[model samples]
Target chain A: GSSRPMKQTKESPNVGDVMSRDVVTVFEDIPVEKAAKLIISGSFDHLPVVSRDGRLIGIITAWDISKAVASGKPSRIAEIMTRRVHSVRLDEPIELAARTLDTHSISALPVVDREHKVIGMITSNHLSRLLARRR
Target chain B: GSSRPMKQTKESPNVGDVMSRDVVTVFEDIPVEKAAKLIISGSFDHLPVVSRDGRLIGIITAWDISKAVASGKPSRIAEIMTRRVHSVRLDEPIELAARTLDTHSISALPVVDREHKVIGMITSNHLSRLLARRR
Candidate 1:
């Protein structure tokens, strides 16, 4: 009755190893239209919002930006960005990152450093890719 | 300084307590265009794909439908629906449901009953609302 494949017991991976390092970030003051263009053209659902010194501040998701555009409202990225961003650290377990994404119902998380500087991004798509590889 | 308000110590909530009972599902054989319209009109990013008997089967995200439409491919909902659906039972803890959504990187989960029938939907937006209430 054991039809399912045995779960792998290999060494657990960390967030740093699985995170995407070619990170794309947006400034807090950019026009919402510009951010929308970046997301549509790049096929990304979320972008980390950063400060002038590159510290992580907020995140903008497709839903927020698209709704604003669809509503034909003029706005700035800061107006639409979610300020209570949930993030993961470089040295944490990927499992924790996954839990964070789940608990918040968010698809991507900004990976931060000791000073809460943006380092990388880990998305549900990335986690899906990792699982696909394992299977 | 204890600036952060005392974390609410109330009894934890369950999936059934927060789920949207009026679920919107699409048949497996429908045209992808129809699905797109439903999403666009409703402002929903995901829909539960069900069998003719209303059995929970798969899921289709706006991303999948939009990409197929954008690529000018003639496709059916069945062709675009993800077959490996992750669902939660009605009686399961909301925390477990949150974890499932997180682990899978999905925004909503189709809540099922003992017979594996589609019952309700719990989404990240709902969770965010719940958290907002707590705060």
Candidate 2:
């Protein structure tokens, strides 16, 4: 038998089940100033960058923009995107996803298909709702 | 006329600037069993309770846990927490404090601080890396 009671399973939920389906993204050629405007206007914390083919090549966030502004670097998106991204599969359990959030200390995870195409975005808020509901 | 350069201004930010300060509150008494555990987990969404504090009497988050779980809810943190919280002056400015999370929907903001309290948190993560070396 398993360690925990089979019926009383799960404490937190999964990224796929909780992440936000509405994600805002940008292209590679966009200027940093323009990207910053999009982040502020769209009221988004992060922006995913996609190639003309719709492949998620990198991710950008408002924080990155702040850093760019403070660093006085190139005012372009491509100049500061995180090519390395931590992502999750849609079907994974919430418990597993929570671990990813904690272990990585990240606020959001981009959910993707097996082909690595972006489907949705999961965040801490999504997880909190699931917890509140079961209560 | 108002303050720093109309454009070259703002440093820290606002509550609307960066606040995961995700309000993940619970009911008056939900046994605290499932609730506490739920917070430990959950991938997203801050299960907003109705009647039920739905009127917005209170808002809770995962951090409340280490507190509640440690204090023992039902046995809950409501029993020991300050009840009095420190919220932000939203619609302020990013240069306000590096101010909120400085992460995901602008690191996430509730956009309403006039309810008295419980708008959003805006953790430190939302603010860091935004300060990453621009080089």
Number of the predicted model whose lDDT against the real structure is largest: 1
lDDT of 2 by residue, B38-103 (tens): 443543323333234343344344333323322223354344333323334567654443323332
Steric clash pairs (candidate 1) = A102-B102
The alpha-carbon deviation from the true structure for residue A67 of candidate 2, after best TM-score superposition, in angstroms, is 0.3
- TM-score (all chains, Cα) for each model: 0.55, 0.48
Local accuracy of candidate 1 as per-residue lDDT tens digits, B50-113: 8888898999775565345334445688886889999988787676766676676676789998
Tell me the interface RMSD of every candidate, in Å.
9.9, 21.1
Error (Å) of candidate 1 at residue A29 is 1.3
In the range A1-135, model 2's lDDT, one tens digit per residue, is 123232212232445646778787778788776676666565555678877766678887655554453344475688888888877888887555556666666666778777777888766545544322321
For every model shown, the clashing-pair count is 1, 56
Candidate 2 lDDT at A107 equals 63
Alpha carbon lDDT at A56, candidate 2: 78
Tell me each candidate's RMSD, in Å, in order: 9.7, 20.7
User: Which residue segments of model 2 deviate by more than 4 Å?
Assistant: A1-14, B1-135
Task: Tell me the deviation in Å of residue A30 in model 2.
Answer: 0.8
